[model samples]
Target chain A: MSVVSLRGVTKRYGDTRAVDDVSFDLHENRIHGLLGRNGAGKSTAMRMLTGQEVPTSGQVRVFGENPYENADVLSRVCFIKESQRYPDIFVARHALEAAAMVFPNWDQDFADRLVEEFRLPLKSRVRKLSRGQLSSVGVIIGLAARAPVTLFDEPYLGLDAVARQAFYDHLIADYAEHPRTIVLSTHLIDEVADIIEHVTVIDRGRIVMDDSSENLRSQAVTVSGPTKAVEQFSDGHEVLHREDLGGFTRVLVSGVPTGRDTASLQVEPVSLQQLVVRTTQFHDAALAGSGNGNGKGNGKGAWS
Target chain B: MDDARPLFQQIAEQIEDSIIDGSLPEESRAPSTNELAAFHRINPATAANGINQLVADGLLYKKRGVGMFVPAGAREKLVERRQEAFGRSYIAPLLAEARRLEMDAEDVKKMIDAWRDDQ
Candidate 1:
C-alpha cells in the first residue's frame, strides 16, 4: 500500500522553484532514505509531507488523504528534525512526557531505559542540554514512540561516531521489533546504507533516483586497474564516473556487464556513498553542459 | 590486549566471551540485528559489520529469511580460531617486540610462568 503519494508537487519561492513537479509513491512497511545535497528541497518536501508547509501546486497524500491540519494524519506521523524546539522551561523528562502524551503507542519503560542509556540529565533544561544529548532525546522519542510513519531529518547532525552508532543500533533493534515506514533524510549515506530498504535521491528540488537499496548497490560496479586496461574494460558500459590516479584509472559504471574479460582488472560494486557522489557529479555535468546554467537539471523529473 | 581496539572487534570479543561463559551455547540463536542495534544504539550498519565478521568466522549463520543463529560447533570453532589468532596477531608480535627490546626467551618464559602462577 502507498503510505504517501506526491503528484506533480511543485514548491516555488518567488523566481526559484524549490520542488518542481516531483511525483512518487512511498510504499508502506519499508525504510526509505531521503537523500539529497544541501538546498535540494528535501527539507521543504518533508515539511510539505508532514503538513508543516503547504505546496505551491500539486497534491501530497498521506495514507490516501491530505495531511495538512489533519489531526488523524498528524498523530500518526512523527517528524524528528535536527532542530526540535521545546519550551525553554521544559526539562529533559518534560520533553519525554510531552512526547509520551503525543504518541499513542509510547512505551514509558523503553523511554526510561533509553534515558539512562544515553546518560541524559533528566533535570537539565532542554536548552541547557548538550547537542549530543539533545539529539539523543529526539532519537529516544522517535524510537520509543513507534509511530507508523517516522521522518528523521538529520537527527544525528552533531553526534560523534560512537553516539551515532548507538543511535543506529537502537533504531535497528527497535525497528526489528516494530517495522514501520521510516524516512531517514541525511547526508550520511554510507553510514546507514545497510538499513535503508528504499532510497530517494533529490537534487535541485527534484527526485533524481528512487529504487530499492539492494538493487542500487548491486547494479553499479567500480572498475579499476591499469589506465588502458580499465578504459578497455569500461568500453560499451555506462560510465557514471572516471578518475585517473597515475597509471591506474577508476570508473564507476552503471550495471555490471557479463562476458567481459575482467581477469586482469579489479571490479567491485560501488559503495552507497560513492554511488551518490558519482550520481550527483553526473547530474551536475549534465546540467552544466545543457547551457541551462539557471535550469534545475531538466526542471525536475530527472530520475529515469 | 589493546584497550582501544575497534568497536566491531570489541563486539566480536564480547560475543566470544558469551560463548566462553556458557551464556550463548553452540547452535543457539544469536541476538537479532535489532537486539544488538537497539541495545548498543549503534548504527545498524556498524553492528551488522561486526556480526558479519562473526558470520565470516563461522560463528553465526542465517536461516534463509529468518534471523541469524549460532552455527553448530560455533563455540568450539571460535575458541580454536581465536586461540590461533591470538598467538599470531598478539603473542607473536609481543614476543618479537620483547626480543627487539633485548628480553631473552628465558625471561619471556619466566614472565609467562609467573603470569600463569599468579592467575
Candidate 2:
C-alpha cells in the first residue's frame, strides 16, 4: 500500500513553480529513487512531503493524513538532507542524542556501531568536522533512526568511494532485516540503480518518468547499424535519442518488439542513467518544439 | 549486474549456473532472499523476485518454514533449458558477427575446428 501520496502538488516560490502539479505514490516497505538534474524540484517536492514546506496548491499526505504540523506522521518520517543544520555550539554526539530522542524507533547500538564504522568524532563540534564527516553524521542518524518512511537527499555529498560503498552495504544489510519505505534522491544513478526497486525521474517541475526499476530496465534499447537498417529497426518505436556518424546510425528506441530479426543490427540495452537522460532530453525537445520556446534549444538540435 | 538485462534475471541465472555446475547440488538448500540481497548488495524485493522466478519455474521449491531447496533433477532440467537457448543466445550473435565480417557457414565451421584443436 502507498504510505505517502502526493496529489497534484504544486509548490510555488514567488513566480517560479518549483514543483508543478506533481502526483506520485510511495509504497510501503520499498526503496524509491527520486532522480533528476540539479534544480529539478526534487528538493522542493521532498520538503513539501516532509512538511517543512507547504504546497501552494494540492495536497501532501503521509500515512493517509496531512503531514503538515502532524506530529504523529512527522515522527514516523525522517528527512535527511545535505544541508541539515545543527546549533552552533552543538557537538556531533548532541545531534545523535537529539535524533535518538525524537525518533521512537531509534537504536542507540546501531548508531554507535555506525559512528565507529564511519570513524566519526563524537566530541568534535559540528562545524569542525570535515565534509565527509558531516555527511556521515547525517547518514548515521538516517540509518539508525529506523523511521517507517525515510527520505535521503544527496546523502553521499563529499563522501569518498569507499565510504559510499560502506553506506550502501550497511543500508542493504540493515534494510533486509528491517524493511521500510525509503526515498533516495541522488544524481548517482548507477550506484543506487540496483538498490532501488522503483524509479521516479523529475525534470524541471514535473515528473517525466515513474515506474518500477525492472520495467524501466527493459523499456528501451539502443540499436546501431547502417543508417537504413537502423531506421528500419526503429520503425514505429518511440525513439528517445538518435546519433549519426557517416553511414552508421544509432537510435535509442522504446517499445521494441521481441524476437525481431536483429541479424544486421547491434542491439544493446540502455542503462538506467542513459534512459533518464534521454527521456529528459526527449521531453525538453518536445516542449521546445511545441512553442514553449525558452530558447534553450540545445536538445532540439539533436533531433534533426 | 550488467545492464544487458534485469538484475533479478541475472540473479536467477547466477543461481542456475551454480546448480548446473554442481556447486549448488540438487536437494540442497538455496540462499534466502535476505542472504542474496546482502551478498549482491541489491534490494531485497529484487532478490525475492529472482527467487520467485525460480520457484515459478519449478527449479526451486519451498520447504514451508524451512527454506527453498533445489528439487531433484533441477540441474539436469536447467542444463537442458540452457542448451535449448544456447543457439539463440550464443550462436546467433556469433553468426551475426561472422556475417558482418563476410564469413560463410563453412568458414565458421573451419574456424570452430581450429579453435577445438587449439583447446
Candidate 3:
C-alpha cells in the first residue's frame, strides 16, 4: 500500500520549475531512496510531500488525504532536512521536547538514548552547536519520533562517518520493530543503496527511474573484454553505457545473458552509485542534445 | 569478500560459509534478520529473503514465534553441497583465469604442485 504519493506534481518557484510532472508512490513499510544530484528537484519534491510546499499544479496525497494544512497527515509525517533551524534561545533538549509533543508515537526514552549515542551536548544552545552536533539534533528527532511517514532530506550534512553508520544501524533496527514508510534523500548513493528497498531517481524535475532496488541491482551489469566478444554478449540488451579503450570495449547492460557462456568477456555488476551516475549522464545528454544543434544524436546517443 | 553477486545471495552465502566452517553449530539459533541487516548495513527484507532461501533449502527451519535455526544434520547436508559445488565455484574460475593469462597445462601443473607443497 502507498502511504504517500505524488501525481504529476509540479512545484514552480516563480519562473523556475523545481519539480515538473513527477509521479511515484512511497510504498508502505519500506525504505526508499529519493536520489539525485544537487538542484535536481529532490528537496522540492520532498517539501511538497511533507506539506511544507504547495505544488503549483498536481496532487500530493498522504494517507489518502491532501497533506497541505491537514493536521491529520502532517502529524504522522516528519520531514528532517540538513539545514533545519532552531531558535537562538532554544537548547538541544528544547528542540527534541518540541518534537516529542508533535509526534504522538514519540518515545522520550529513545530520544534520550540517541542523544547520548550521538554525543550531542544537551546543554548547548542549538545555534551555538557545531555542524556535526547540529546534524545530530535532527537525526535524533527523526529517529525517535517514530512517525509513520518519515522523510529525511539529506538529514546528515556535517556528521562524521561513524555517526552516519550509527544512524543507519539505529534506523534499520528501529524500523524492524515498527514498520513505516521512509523516504531518505542523499547524494551518498553507495552507502544507502543496500539499505533502501526501492529507488526513485529524479533528474531535472522528472521521475526518470522508479523501481525496486533489487531490479536495479540484478539487471545492471558491466561487460568488458575484446570488442567483438563484448558486443556479442551485450547484443539485444539495453546498453546503458559503453566505452572504448584501444582494442577493448566495455558496456553497461540492463540485461543478464542466458547460459553463462561468458567465456571472453568479464561480466561485472554495476554498483548503485554507478547506475545512478550513468543514468543521469544519459538523461542529461539526451536533453542537451535535443535542446540544441539539429537534434541529430538526441535519442541515438542516449542509449548508445 | 568482494563479489558481483546480488546482496541477498552474498548474505545467504555468508551464513552458509559460517555453517560450513563450523562457526554456526548444528541446531543453533540463526541470527535474526534485523541483526544481520544492521550488521551488514543492508535492508532487513534482503536478509529475510536470504534466510528464507536457506529455510526453503532445509538448511534452516523456523520455530513458531521464536526464530530461524539450523536443523539437525544441516551441517552434513550443507558440507555435501559445498563439496559438490567446489569444483564449479573455485577450480573452474581458477582455470579460466589461468587460461586468460596464457598459462599452458605444464605451467598450471607447476603452480598446483607449488601450491600443494606450500599447503
Maximum-lDDT candidate: 2
DockQ of 1: 0.15
Best of the candidates, TM-score: 2
By summed lDDT, the worst window of 10 consecutive residues in model 3 chain B runs over B1-10
C-alpha root-mean-square deviation, each candidate: 9.6, 2.7, 3.7
Ranking according to lDDT, highest score first: 2, 3, 1
TM-score of chain A of each: 0.94, 0.96, 0.94
Q: List model 1 lDDT by residue over B1-119, tens digit each.
A: 11223445666778878986789987777876666756655445446667898888878888887778877787777778778788888878688778878998789989999999999
Q: Clashing pairs in model 3?
A: none
TM-score of chain B of each: 0.71, 0.95, 0.85
A1-304 per-residue lDDT for model 2 (tens digits):
9999999999877877778899999999999999987777899999999999899999999999999999999999999999999999999999999999999999999999999999999999999999999999999999999999999999988999999999999999899999999999998888998999999998778899999999998899999999998988888889999999999999999876576667778899888888988998898878877876334345534311
Q: Ten consecutive residues with minimal summed lDDT in candidate 2 chain B? A: B1-10
What digit string (tens of lDDT, one per residue) describes model 1 on residues A64-128?
Answer: 88999999998999999998999998999999999999999899999988888888899999999
Q: Per-residue CA lDDT of candidate 3, range A1-304, in tens?
A: 9988899999887777788889999999999999987777899998888888899999999999999899988999999998898888999989998999999999988998999899999989998999999999999999999999999989888999999999999999999888898989998888898889999998778888899988888778899999999888888887888999999999998878777568877888788888987887777777886783222233333321
Task: Give me candidate 2's TM-score against the actual structure.
Answer: 0.93
True contacts kept of 3: 0.63
